[model samples]
Structure formats: C-alpha cells, structure tokens
Target: MRARKTTMLALTAGALTAGLAAGVAAPATATTSVLVKPGKARPGQNVTLQVPECETDGFATSDAFAGSAALDGAEEVEGRAGLATIGAHTPPGTYQILAHCGDVNAVGQIVVLPGTAPSPRPTPHGAADAGFGGGAGGVNVVLLGAGGVLLAGAAVARSRRRDDVTA
Candidate 1:
C-alpha cells in the first residue's frame, strides 16, 4: 500500500509537470528575411512583401513589379510590410524580389502564372477590417490549469478513500 501511494504520487507529479510545460507558450522568433505571400501569383495580382527584420521604410524591386513598390509606414520591425502589384505585362516566369531596408536586404520570389488577365486593384484596407484572429492560435491556460488541479485532487481523494477503507 505504501509503495502504491508513492508510485501514484510520482505519476501525478509527472503528469502535472508535463501539463504545465505543454501549456507554456513558446516564444516567437523574429523573421530575418523577407517573405512573400502567395508565392505563386497571376499577373496584376497584388502580393504582400513582409520584412519583419527591417527597421526603416524601404522598397522592393522585381521585374514583375509595375514599378518598385514602396515599403513605408510603421517603423517597427514587425510592422514592415508593403504591397507590390504584379505588372499586367510581366511575362509568366519566376521573378526574384529584392527588398532593401536601411542596411538589411532580403530576397524572395513570386511566380507569375500564365494566362491570367489583370483586374482592377481593390481599395486597400486596414488589417482590422479583415476581421482576423477569431480566437485562433490561442492556448487556454486557465482551463488547462483547472483540469490539472482537478485531476490531482481526484487522485489524492481516491488515495485517501483507499486509506480510510484499509484503516
């Protein structure tokens, strides 16, 4: 009986530790290079260039660009992003996109698919207007903690009940 209780306590501690560790969120790593959304795009389609490592306003150059797209507004590193329109006349091929920050340079590419016609550019809107983050990528720490506590409590209660019956 003594050995059984000891084993149960050890198992409970292990379970609780594992649960807490799982609940703890990992730190986000900053991007050190440019990232292009929609790696494959049709001509005249707008592609977003993300330069999370950039500190100042910059621009992106590409043969596919209507012209060089300006990366401006919000000097914060994470906020460094811009829109580059794929030229209607850009040939169907993979084009290298080079983004230039203050002193940082990052490269990415966009592939223009063949045969898509250019459409009118839609009005740009704020991210909030997109209504994103609908409770996505969230960890329910409070619920997890509560569940762990309840599990530990139940284990202790069952062990005590066994003791009471034996006594």
Candidate 2:
C-alpha cells in the first residue's frame, strides 16, 4: 500500500509538469500593431493613434506624452483607433506616444512647434466712451438692483391679493 501511494503521487506530479510544459510551448495568440497619424503636432492639437490588429471586441491603450502625461483610450474595432489630445500647455519638444495592446506595444514620436505669440490686446476706448462703466462691475450692480425691485414688487402684489381674498 505504501509503494502504491508513492507511485500515484509521482504520476500526478509528472502529469502536472507535462501540462505546464505544453502550455509554455504554445505560442501566444495576442498580436497587435500600432500607427500614428501626422506624427507631428503643436500643443492643443489632436493626435490620432491607430491599432490595426487589435482585438475585435476592444482593447485598452494608453499614450505617454513627454514621459509625463499619460492618456488612455479604447480600441473598439479593427479600424477604429485610440486618440489623445496634446495638452495646450505642453512645451515644444519631441515627445513619445506609446500604444499598448495586451503584451504588444508600439511607440511613435511627435514634434511640437512653438506656438505663435499672442497678439497684445488693444487698450479699451476711453472709460467714458466704453459701455457699462468701462466694462467694470457697474452693469452687474444695476442689473441686481432691478432684479431686487422686481422681486419686491411681486411680493407686495401677492400679499395684497391674499389680503383681499381673506377680507
């Protein structure tokens, strides 16, 4: 009986090892490819990343920007791809965009151009010539006062109607 028990244990161990080896020998089935459009953009521009060979149902992908910003989107279908918007304040430089599909990963680079300088705002017309107290808080105060008067008038009318009905 002791010998039989030992043999059974050894057979079980051997079977488990064989099963693990078979699993390891099998090739992985998850394959993917990634692509990016226009490869270069400026801050505030939209960048599209395509994963043509992703899973049919969907897969999660992420974009790593300048090694700091990380954006994630899903690949819903074969042709449909992920998208990430370059931040408006992203500095002008070369940045990387990474797309991950299961164990496969792809990377692309983007060059951001320095945006044009903002035009200086023209000085407003003379304060008296401008509307609403030179675009200050005067208009807001006047509107608030008018609203308060209308509310008070409504309350007075409602109270008078109630008093007449009661009488």
Candidate with best TM-score = 1
**Candidate 1 C-alpha lDDT tens digits along 1-167:** 99999999999999999988876754333335668888888887889888877778889999999999888766543747899988988889999888887767778889999877566679866444333454444567787799899999999999999999999
lDDT string for model 2 (63-163, tens) is 32422322244545454375566666777777665555544555567676678324447887644544544453345767879989999999999999999
Off by over 4 Å in 1: 1-32, 75-79, 117-167
Give the clash total for candidate 1. Answer: 0
The CA-based lDDT of model 1 is what? 0.81
For each candidate, give its TM-score against the true structure.
0.49, 0.39
| Candidate 1 residue pairs in backbone clash | none
RMSD of model 1, in Å? 33.6
- Which regions of candidate 2 deviate over 4 angstroms? 1-33, 56-80, 116-167
